[model samples]
Structure formats: structure tokens, C-alpha cells
Target: MMTGGPEPDSPDVMSVLELLAVGAPPARFEELLRTARREEAPDSTLAELDQAVRLASRVQALIGHAQQREAGLAALVDTAHDLTLVHGMEALLHEIARRARRLLNFDMAYIGLRAADDEGRASSIRAAEGETTSLSVGLKTFEDSGLGSLVQRSGAPAWSPDYLADRDLPHSPDIDAVVRAEGLHAILAVPLGYGTTVFGTLYGADRKVRHFTPDEISLMRSLGRLAGVAIERARLLEATRAEVTELELDTSRARSSLNVQRRVEAAYIRLIDLVLSGCDPQTLAEAAVKELSGALVVRDCVGRTIVVTGTPPRLTEDDVLRWTYDAHAAGCPVPMPDGGWVAPVTAGGENLGAILLVPDEPLTDGFGVRLLQLTARAVALILLLQRTSTVAHDQIRDELLDELLSDIRTQPRQLIPRARRLGIAIDEPHVMVLARPEGGPEGRAAAWASSYAHRMSGLMRFRDGYVTLLVPSEDPLAAATAVSEELTPLVGHPVTVGAAGPVSGPGRVAQAHREALSCLEALTELGNLGCVATPQQMGFLGVLLSENRGVGEYIRSVIGPVVDYDTQRFTELTRTLDAYFASSSSPTRAASDLHVHPNTVSRRLERIAELLGADWQDPERALEIQLALRLHRTRRTLQHRHAATGAARDAGSPAPRGSGP
Candidate 1:
């Protein structure tokens, strides 16, 4: 195998020594030695050259070993730097495997992390580099066999040259198969960790049978220790980051809570200021709406609107009432249509009203709802105060009305002042209206009367089972008629009203009241239920029913013969006489008025004269006949009107077509 170096016969000891000292090829040294021996130089010279060549060869080998160690140490320094910079455990493991294969000149290098479960324990290859087949990353091995287990258990480096033949350690058939498949003949591994806590092992293997030097094993151990420290450092950093994140979340929550409190405080201050300013319910509601940037409607207990602010959601009265009921029951704000909300305005357990709010946008949280509740409470207080004031005023007015209607006559001096205080001018002309509830509950009639009287600025009270109002008016009958029409629908039944007086002062009130009562009685007696009447409108019937009863004498004298004729014949000769007189005694006009021919009228009149005396045609008697006929017709018309009303009443309907006398 040695060629082109030196001839074997030539003696060249100095030259070969020079070549050996300068690190020439082994072939060159071998050729120089062969030439020195063939030259047959002196035995001492041959021996000296041989010793010199051997010494030079030994020195060269030492220098080469030193340089390799130096290079390995430099690579270890670079690995330490790389490990310190690596951020994750897996990346550091891969880098360690790569550096190990490069430094040791192994066919394959890999790291195996120890994994233990309740069922069993094993080492799984986590990272690998170089030419690997069966011993790839994620390969697992049990502790019974494999170099990983030996290194982990002993906490030391392990190596086996000619791994298939080594029998000092237990070998698993499966592990051997993997090693053979990987074409590995030698293996070296070092425990990766500090002290006795070996997390895993780093492995390096060669395809050819070769011994692993101690320096290489030690270098790998150093790298494994550095990898373990790096992994622990990464874990600590990750835990610190988690803690920082949680702290930030808590801080954000605290800030949000503080902000909410501040806003609530500000809103409370604004509400208190509004209340102290004596603002009306509407004004206060508007302020609240402005603050919340929403619309609101406030309603009273009876579902009447008290105030409305902004353009609240469109809802019917029934919708508002339903929402109010639900909110009151729940004692909280409830959602409504169009992104609105409703809250009951309650005070001292009384649901005074409700407030409906329609926001410009939907609420994102409970704060807006809570704000609405606060506003509702403010509105409730305002409503309660208003109601209390109204009740006190009504009490005063009711007391005054009671005194005015009292039967005991009070001096004008004593009454006028009291009347003026209640906004009534007792000295002015006022009519006394006596109203009787017809086929209806008296209590509701009285309540409605009181309310109506208040609206008219008059006085009302229940007296002698009648709801009476003394209102300012010149036409008592017209006022009575107006009251009847107005009260019919409200009471859900008919009401008969009888009015008397343009009574001038408080002194004449009792007399006027008696007149109204008598008129009311006359209406009932005449079958005129649900009718309005005054003494003047009742004509002669009114005159007959008056306190002065002398008009009966005049009636009997003027129409006695006709009355007797009617009683005898059971005919309406008296009605014919009355129509004749009403038509100015013209036979033709009288026939037309009675819806008959002139012959019938003339014959009736002749019969009436025959029943009395022929002298009834004289002017003195004729004048008397005319007056009596007029009175009789008045009575007959009233009787017919009464009959019609009675028929209607019997039918269980409203008053007949004609309303008043």
C-alpha cells in the first residue's frame, strides 16, 4: 500500500525524522523506516533512527489528540451560549442533539425525556438529529433495556462499543432490533439534569463499532446539565407571565367598579337638586330623561298620563297598564317593546304610577335599569305630594258645601265669607239643582255630581237622598238640563234633574231648595223619569203644584161643564173645546189643529154648548171658556208625555225620545 515516498534500500533517518516531526503521513514514515533497514547501516545507527521515528510518531499523535480536545472544548463553549439563548425546552433539546452529533461525529443523536404514568414508566425520544431510522424522535423505550435507562438510573454517562455483543447490561430484543435497523454498532448516552434528578438522557450512536472517549461523554453531560437549567428557566418565566396576566384582569375590574360608583353618585346628586328646586313632575321626568339620554312617560294609578318626556315608545294605554302591573309585581324594571323599559312608580308600598322609558339604543348593562328605578322613585314621591295637597283642598271644599246645604239658616254675613274662601260667590244668582239617580247606584251618582260641581266652580252635597249642586247660572232649567245630559254616560244610567231659583243670596237657599225638591217630586209623580224640569216649564201643572193652591178654583169655574160632558159621554169633547179655543175659536183652524174636518169640530162645540147652556157662546162666558180650555190642554199634553215616558221606562230602556218639559 505504501508508494511514491522513498526506496527501501536508501538510508534516510534524518529526513524521515523531519517528516514525522512535521506530521507527515504514516505511509511516509513507514517508507523511511524500511529504507533505513535495507541500507544495512550500523546496528546502533539503525536502532537510533528507529527509536527517533517512533518518538516522532508518538509526539505527532499526542499533538493531534490535543487539537481535537481543543476543538471539542471550543464547541462546548458555543453550545453553552446557544443553550442560554434558546427560549423553549423542546428547541433546546433539538439544538443539544444536533451539537452532540457534530462534536462526536456520530451517525445519529437523540434525546429521550423520562415519562411516568400510573400504569408504567418509559423514556420517549423527544428530539433527534443526524441519520436516524428506528431511533427517531418520539420513539419510546422501557427502563428494562436501552442506554437511556442506564444513564438515568446511574446519573452518569454510559457507552457501549459493539452494542450487539455487549452483555454486561440487559438488552431488549425490541431495542436491539431498532438499533440494528438504525445500523448502529456503538452507543453513548449521558443523563440530562443536575444532581440525582435526571429528567432524561441525551444519546449519541455510531454506525461503525468504535469506542466513545471520556472527553466526548463528559462534554455531552455538560450540555445536558445546561439544557435542564434552561428548561427550568423557561418554566419560571411562563409562570411569571401567567401571574402578570391575572393581576391585570383584577386591576381592570377594580377600575370599572370605581367608574360605575362615580357615575351613580353624580346621577344621585342631579336628582336631589331637581327635587329641591320644586320642579313639576313633567320637568323632573324630562331632566331624568336627559341625563339618561332616553324617553319616559309617567302615568297615574288610574292609568291617566301625568307627564311625558321625550318621544317614548309608541304604546297603547292597555299596554302601559299591563307593563305597570308586571313591574309592580316584580318590584323591578321590565323590558318593553322598541328597546324600552318600564318601572313602577311606587311609594310606601303603593303603586302610584309607572314610568316607561325608550332609550335611543339598547342598554348594555344593569346600570341603566337601576338609574330608571331611581327616577321612578323620585316621580312617585312627587305624585304622592300632589295627591296629599289635592286631598286637603278637597276636604275644605267638601266642608263648605256641607254648611251651604244645611237646613239651619245661616246669616249672610257668616256664609258669604265662607263661600268666598271656597271660590263660590254666594251673593250672586245661583240655581239649586236637585238630581235623583234613576235606577242606578246612589253612591256613584253622588261622586259624579261632586266632581261635576267642582269643575263648574259650584258647591255640591248629598242631602235628603239627593245629589244637589248649587251652581252660578241665570237659567236654572237650562243648567239642570245640561247637568242631566253630562251625567248620563258617566253614571251609566239616567238621572232626573229639577232646578229652582236664580236665588239672589244665601238667605233664600232653603226656599230655593224646597222649590227644586218639589219640582223633582212633580217629575216623578208625572211619570217623567229621566227628565229635566223647572217650575216655570211645567206650566199650569207647576202652578197647581205650587205652595199657593188657589189656582184650582179658577180651573173649576172655567171648564166645569166640559169636564162634566166628558165624564158623561166618555168622549174627548173637552179636548175638542180646548183645541177650538187654542185656534182662536176659528172652526177651520180648530179642525186642522185637531187633525179633523171642520164639521167634526163644529158638531163637538155645539154638543159642548148643549151640555152646558147656550149662553156659553157669549163673550164673558167665551173668555172664561178660552182660559179653561188653555189650562185643560196644558194638563192633557203633560199627561200624554208622562204616558210615553212610562212606557219607555217599563221597557227597561233609556228615557223616551223627548227629554225635558
Candidate 2:
């Protein structure tokens, strides 16, 4: 309906535009227009004001619609995270349908499962929500061309604006009758299944004729996919429960004997208590040792002894391996070469380790053997829990490292929170250690590195034949030595380690890696493959081998603090060091050379120690410090001579003879 009014000019339109900008309501706008009319304002002004109000109203409606959709999407995300805690299939399906209806504001939503034999041709509604009539539930359809059937066949969403009036797609008479009776229209059906296996369809319908937006259709499809995954998980959980129940029944029947039953019951009770108390491998081994009449020994999968009690016969690697194979094959305790019994610690057919029970005498009784086997199972469980925890922790650490190392552009501030979650204070001074085991399997070394890093509350990454760890230690050389010492025996071979940095922040991790690599390369070049060293320990050779040729950095790293202190206070520590070194370690001679008392030279040396470290005079550190002092003095002398020559030349005088090119 058009209202007669004069055409709008620029001035009248601008006034109405200002009203619209403030979001003035139509009522206020109408009042303004009425006042304008009373004031004998032009018809164009009234018309323009009316138009602005309409525009503002439409914008508000659109904004409100957008916010509602955003809230619905957020709810969908929450539902996905919540689905993991659901247990029953029926309850989960019902929840899925209800959420879909609520999120999409549908009149009704239902889930339909296709018949197993008919293959998308026949389906019956399994769950429904927001249904006005009970007929929607228990509803069955057999038509091949129905909405649900089509969605099931194609594994895509199908919709019709008017359910009964749409002729492009065929519909079953019974289904149409229910829809007509319910006055339903604007129906949508999306297939629910994982990947290529289409098992069912989810349908959303509205009573009034409406067009579902693309987002609404996509939301329904996402719900369908999530439902499919949830269904799969539920089915797997049920299967696992059934298997556990059956295994328990079989175990009970196997332990039917009175003595065996008593032992089994007591052992199982103790095992549960051990697990609930968060017992470690050593504790579990100790419990087994207490039960045994003689001695017990536990070793990890790699033949590393975890716990030993009493005077158990020493077993060589071959002995352990052979006995382990026999015990695993026999599925119980087997006799050891020393007349003892050994049981394989295993979980889900994976070998975790072995437990050896060396009783005082040979026991032919089944009870002793069964007890040994139970002990092994407990050990397996403990080890499995430890392995799982270590794996999860390592995964998080590796993720952080991946972000740091792979992407050099990643900000350290962004990774601080993730590092803190793993108990790594990334801002604290830390050293980077790079280790390469000279022998043993790389995988074993990597596993050990991961476990070691976790135990030390550090992060590690195994890449390109090297295991890199970022440990919170200020002394890189000591850290490297410790890693090599600890890993060498465990790996059954030499492990070369190189280290760099007491870097204060994680941002310099990449730089530390490069420096550490240079140390490693320098060691390898000198045939020092089974040793530990830092770039500072490598001396001037480190600068030559390093890619960055960090000679100035190396010199500064050793003597920069001393030089800075001397510059700030105008001290003679640098001269004292050179004189002390030149006088063949004689403080009297250095004092005589400096023409000062020996006591003054001693005080300067002590200050030098304070500036450097207490270990500044250690053989290795002293060598580095002496090298830094010589290089620092030489560079200074060259600078002074060059400056003198430049000044002489600038004064129109001949340069000094030795300084000439």
C-alpha cells in the first residue's frame, strides 16, 4: 500500500537518515512525521522518515536472527563434547533427536533406521522429538522413494517446502497421511552413518510451510554425522563389555578348585587395591615379593631391571629372553634355568616385561604357579598404566615442540600456556640437549628419551636420528654429561650428547638447537663420537665448525660479563687476566709486571672469578676463559692501532709503517 507524498530531496532525506542511525523506533518516527505535518513540513520529509524506520526495523530483525543462529551453533559444539559421556544407545539417539529439534526450532524431529534386509527401502522411526502426535513414533515406511529412503540411499539431505504438494519426489500414502493429518510441511531428512555405511536417516519437519535455509540443512547434516559416530562408539563399548563379562565367566570356571579359588580371590582383591592406591611398578613387585617364599625380580620390556628382592639368581639377557618366550607361549609361569619360575607380563597380547619368582625350593603345586601368574598380570597392569600416562604426556609435549621447532615463526608467548600445562616453566632458564645413541635400536632410544624427558618435567622431540630435550638446567655441559651417563648404560652403548644455552625463554630454542648441533658436528669430526660436550667446551674449533661462525658470540659468552663490569667501573680485570696468563701462573710476576702489589692482583683475580663463575679456573673453563681473553685483547689492540692510523692520516700525516696495507 502506497501513501501519497511528495518526492524526497537531499535535506529531508539526510534528517531521516540521522534518525535511522540512532535506531529510532517506528512509533517515534511516526510522531516526528506528525509534528512535521503540523509544522507545515513537506510531504517528502514524512515519506523519507517512514522509509528510515522500516530500514532500521529490518536491520534489527537480521541482527537478532544472526545472534540466534550463532547461539545454536555454539550449542551444537557443546552437544558434541557432551556426547562422549553418554552410555546407552537408546538414550543417546533420543538426545540427538531432541537436540536437533531444539537447535533448529523444528516442529518435530525423528530418527529412522533402515531395515537390515530391505536396504534403504524400509525403515521405522526409532526416536522422535517435538512431535505433536504420537503417530510419528513407531511410524514405519516401506516406500523406496520416500524422503527418509532417498536420504538413506544417497547419504545426503533431502527437503521439500510443502510435504504433500511437492511432486518432484514420490511419497508413501501412509507417511503422507500422517504428514497431512499433522499438517506438517518443510520436511528435511539427512542420512546417519559413518563413511560409506548408511544405516539410518534423521528427519526434521515443520507444521507450517517454510523454507529451510542452507545453514539449517547443513546443521541437520552435521547432527546426522555426529549421531553416526556416537552410534559406532556405543556399539564398540557394548561389544567390549560383553567380551569382559564372558572372560570373567571363563576365568571363574578355570579357577573352580578350592585352593586355586582361594588364591585367585585373594590375589584379585589385592590387585584391585594396588591399582586403586596408584601403586608403581616397584610397589607391585614388592607386593609379589612379599607373597613369594623366596625372591622376585622384575624387568622392563627392554631387559632393564626395575625391582629385585632377595638373592634371586642372576639372569643374563639371553636367559631372560628365552624364559620370557617360554612363559608367553605357555601362558603361565615357566621354570627358569636356575630351578625358578618366570612369568611374562603382557596386556592384550603385547609384551610389557617379565617377572621372575625364585622360590626356595621347586614347587610342583599349581597354587604357586597361579600366584606367580597373577603377580605378572598385576605388573602388566601397572606398566600399562605407566606407559599410557607417559604416552599422553609425551604427545602433549611433542605437540608443543612441533609448534616451536617446525614453525620458527610461532610466538613464544603463544606456547607459554601449553608449556606450563606440562609443568615446564618455559620462561625459566633452560638448556637444550641433543643426544645420539651410538648403538641399540633408534626406537628404543627414542622411547627412553620420551620417558626421561617426562620424568625430568621437560619436553623432548626425536627427529632425524637425534633426540632433543629442553631441560631446566643452567649448565649445558653438566646437563649433557648427565644425559650421556644415564642413557649409556640403559642403551647398552655409548651415547654422544651436545648441549647449548641457559636460554631464558623458549623463543631461542631454535638458536640453541643450532648451537647444540654444531657442538655435535664438531665432536663427530674429531672422532669423539661417544662423548659429551658443549660449544664452549669445543673452544675456537667450535666457531670454525659452526654454521653461524659465532666467534664474537663465543668470546662474549665467556668474557662479556667481565668486560661489561670493567667498562662500567673502569677496572683492570682484563689486564690482570692477561698478565696472570703471561707470567706462567705466577701472581708475584703478574704484580711485578703491572707494578702493583701481589695482594691487589689476587683481589682482581677473585673478582674475575666472581664475574665468570667459581669454576672459571677449572681446566676446561679456564682454557675457554684464557682463549676469550686473548681474542678480546687482540681485537682491542687492532682497533686501537687502526684508529691511531686513521687519526694520523686525517691530520695530513703519513700512517704508521706497520699499519700500512
Candidate 3:
């Protein structure tokens, strides 16, 4: 051997150089060192060989550490990619645990999340992966010595190389029991979440005793950070998704409500148009039926059907009455027996009538019901307009009649033209009727008369607390009777109607009115309540009660046939009638007074029966005939006396009283 240094070509030196250059196993270099030592090499050579063996071991160890760092870096890159790809919190946490176990090369790995409200005071294992027993998952602890709490407090990684045997870190018995049961020897806990604020801990554990390298710890901490970011991303995505769902629901609801509002508005516009066009209740009901898809029945206040649209459900009068009452009480629509609704048509706090609706399908919401209510209001509006028109027309009629009957002198000049305009024929024959209610409401009789006059094409006037009418009728009795019959039930009491002449001309109205007033007064004086009568129907009292005081007409009405027969036949029937009355209806006595046979008197009586009715012998007829005969005889006697007086005056005057002779 050379003294200065081992020869460049030395076997041991060459073998070690070759092994270092080729990157061979340290075991091969060790085998060469042991063979040199056994062969008794020189001291210098042995020292050099020993140095070579030491150098080879350090270089190999450095190379192994570098390879481990490279592997950990590759795993970290993969873990970052996977953590970024994972979506939900739970799945991301599970993936993080799995990556942590594989990255750190641990027996098991898990993630522990702190209670949100505990502020790092408590934590529970949320996810686990690798060869973990069931005891590892869902493990929770509140102890300050637990690794999760330690990592949270320190805001850094906490590790135990041998959990059961380590004394450097605080220990919790509960956590220790889980460690023992799972046979976990080494455990490393790293903080997860943003810097300095750990919401949870990422854990890597092993069943075998092992010390954690800085690279492993660093890799695990990186993975925890990536997991924390991914978890937050997933939570935000979930929140965003929830917000979007809620917004979609709100949008849908708003759209539906808008659609309903549009429909309701359309219906309102159509109905308002109908109302403005002066449509009748029937037309309004038809529109409402179309809108509501139902049948409609409109009634009057008295429950008479004014109009019916669609096929309405049958309802009796009693049912309508009862439903109307209930609807009025409720001030809204009431359910009917046929699964329909009755809405009271009210205006100005008055129940005008009701609109009954029979729907084809039961209502699911207030939309249909609301339309029904709207229809009811529309119908009420139409009815109110019609009634207003009617009332106005009636007022006009009343005013015309009042002006006509007020001053008869000016009636033909001004009122006749106006009457013609109103379709009232004042020139035609019309009976004047005056009436008074016997124990009834004060104003109802006037209302009844107004309405009746309108219906009968007549004129009505309420003056001085009496209802007066001028109706076109030939029969005064019939007109008076009609007034009584119509006005009684309306006023809920008896009505006394007194009628007079069926006046033919305009100026005669006042005279007829006076005669009717006198007849009314007569009937009242005679206690004829609720009785209808004309002056002619009152018999002889009619002439006395009449304003014209028709005496000659009354006499003619009673015995005109007899007087005409005596004049036309040139007979003594008047003398025989006077004798008969003087003999107290004894024809034989009368015949004896006339110096004739009773048989001749009987023939004259038969002729009188033929001229007068067969009932001439009746008590009432006899009385009327007797009164007429007396009046007739008195008038004839006065005429004879006046004639004698005229002749006496002529005789008493000087025949030659003429100054000219």
C-alpha cells in the first residue's frame, strides 16, 4: 500500500466509489467494508474504508428522506385536486379524512368538528376513513386535554407519538379509552379552517408506535386547510341553492296572483260596462253567469223572480224567504240548501232583493264568491236605476195630475197637451175616484195609488191627505171597486173609494172630482168603511150627496119609463099612479075613485108592470116610485097655478089699458 493515501486502484476504495456512483444498496457497500476488515487491511486503509461506509450510510439516508418529501408533495397535490372537486360538506370531510390517512400513511384518519356554539370547548368526530373501528367515528369530548381542544387552543398541529405512553401532551381519559379500544398508538391532530380560527381538527392515527415527521405533519396541515376551504365552498353552494329555490317559489306565487288579479279586473271591467250601458237586471245576470260559470236568479224585494239566467237550482218561496233573511242578517252571501249561495242585493242599507247562484262546481276559493258578490252589486245597481227612473216618471205624472186637478179653468189650455205627451188621454171618458184608507199606514195608500195608476194607465194625485185617481173607464162603480181592492192589502187595512161621473171632456174633471168628494163624504158619514160606490149606486141619497144636486135626473132614473109612456100613449097612467099611491097601492080602491071597473085598473097595472120592471112592487122600488110620483104631481100643480095666475093678471089688467086707444 502507498503511505501517503490509499491507492486510486485499491479494491475497497474502488468498490465504494463504484457503489456511490451507481447508487447501489448500502448493504452491498457494508458487505465490502466487512470483508476489508476481516482481511486485515492496513490501518490507513481500514480507516478510509470505515469513512467510506459512514459516508455511504449518510448519503443513502438523505436520499431516502428526499424521496419521502417528494412522495408527500405529490400526495398533497392530489389531495388539493380532490378537495377542490368534492362538493357537499360531509362528503368533502370524508374525502379529506381518506386523503389524510393515505397522505400521512396512518392506520386511520378522521375529522372532528367543534360545536358551533362551544367556542372550541367541545368537539365530535364527524368523518373517518381507512382501517378505523367504529369507536373512532362519532367520538366526542369536552376535556381540555383532548387533542382536538389542544389543537384549537394552540391553533396548530398537536401530536402524540405514543398516545398510551406519551407524557409530553395532556391526556383525556375518554379520548384515551377510544384510543385504547381502537388500538391507536400515535395520533396527530391539526387545526382545520382559516388561519388562527379553527372550527375543527383533522386527525391521523396509527395502531403502531411511530413518530410523525415534519413533512407528514406539514402535508396533513395543508390538506386540512384545503378541506376547510372546500367545506366552506360546499356550505355556500348549499345556501345559494336554497335561496334560489325560495326565490323560484316566490316568483311562481306572484305570477299566479297576478293571473288571478288580471281575471278579476277583466270581469270588473265587463260588468261596469254593462252597468253603464243601462242594461237590465236580466242582462247583468247573464254576464255574471258567464263570468262565474253558474246559474243566476234575480228576485225582487217581495221575492218575485225578476230574471233567471242559466239552469238554476229549484228553490221554493219559503226557501228563498229564509235565505233572504239569513243573508240580510249576515250582510253577505249565505249558503243555500242546494250547495249554492244567495247574496242579498243591498243598496243604501236597504235589502232590495237577492241573487241566487248555483255553481257547476263547488268553489275552491273566494274568487267565484267574490264575483258573485260583485254581480249582486251590479244587479242591485241596475234595479236601483230602474226604480229611480220609475220614481221620476211617477213624480212627473203626479205633478201633471196635480196641476190639472188644481185649477180646472186652465186644464184644457195647458194640461191637455202635457197629458197627451204623457200618453194620458184627458179628452177620453175617465172616472174620477177619491179614496181614503181606514186605519192604515199614512203614506202607503198614496204609494199604492201611484203605482196602481201607473199600471192602469191612469193619473194619480195625493192631495189633502187623500189619494185621487182619474182612470179611463166607462163604469164608475167598477173603477171605484178596483181602487178599493188594490189599495186594501197594500195598506193592510180597508179602503173607501168614492167615484163620480165618467167625465168626457177636460173641463168636467173638476166637477167630477167634486162629485166624487161629496160621495166620499157621504159614504164616510154613512159609516161605509171599505166600501166602493159611485153616486148612482147610492140611490136617492146619491142625488142629495152629489155636487150637481141632480133632482130631475134622479126622478127620471126612478120613474122616467112611466112618465114617457103617459106622454107618448096620451094616457092617464100618471093620474092612475097618483090615485094608486093615494089608495095605499090598492088598485080596486083607485079604480073606484077613477069611476072605472077594477078589471080595467088591473089591465093598467099590467101595462105599468110591463113598462116598469116586474119588481116595481118591491119595497125599495115602491118607495122610489112613490117619491117620484109626488114630485111629479107637485111640479104639475105648480105649473097649473102659474098658468092661472098669468091669465088672472091678463084679465085683471084693463083690457083697454092701451094709452094709444
Candidates' TM-scores?
A: 0.35, 0.46, 0.48
Candidate 3's residue-wise lDDT over 460-565, tens digit each?
8765567889999999999888878766655557888899978876777878888899888888888987888888988788877777757788888888988999
Q: Cα lDDT for residue 184, model 2?
A: 91
Please report how far candidate 3 places residue 659 from its true position, in Å.
Answer: 28
User: How many steric clashes does model 1 contain?
Assistant: 0
Error of 2 at 59 (Å): 24
Q: At residue 73, what lDDT does model 1 achieve?
A: 61
Error of 1 at 552 (Å): 10
The C-alpha RMSD in Å for every predicted model, in order, reads 51.6, 15.2, 50.9
Q: 338-380, model 1: which lDDT tens digit per residue?
A: 6788898765354466888888878775557767877786676
Model 1 misplaced regions, further than 4 Å? 1-279, 291-308, 311-384, 387-396, 434-454, 462-467, 481-499, 514-576, 579-661
Per-residue lDDT of candidate 2, residues 1-661 (tens digit): 2123322333355555565566555555555566667777777767776676567667767767768766765775666756655778789889889888887889888898766676556788888887777787788877566798778666679999898999888777889978987789889989887434677888888989989887688667766766776765565445434644554665678766656556555765576479547788777777766666788888776566889888876667667777776787787888876788888876545456688888987767665776777677667655644443343334446657766665355346868887887798988988889998887656556656766787778888776678899999999999999898777765567888889887877678777877898888778888998898886677777776455556688888889988998899999888898899899889999999999999999999899888888988788887888998888888888989999999998999999989944
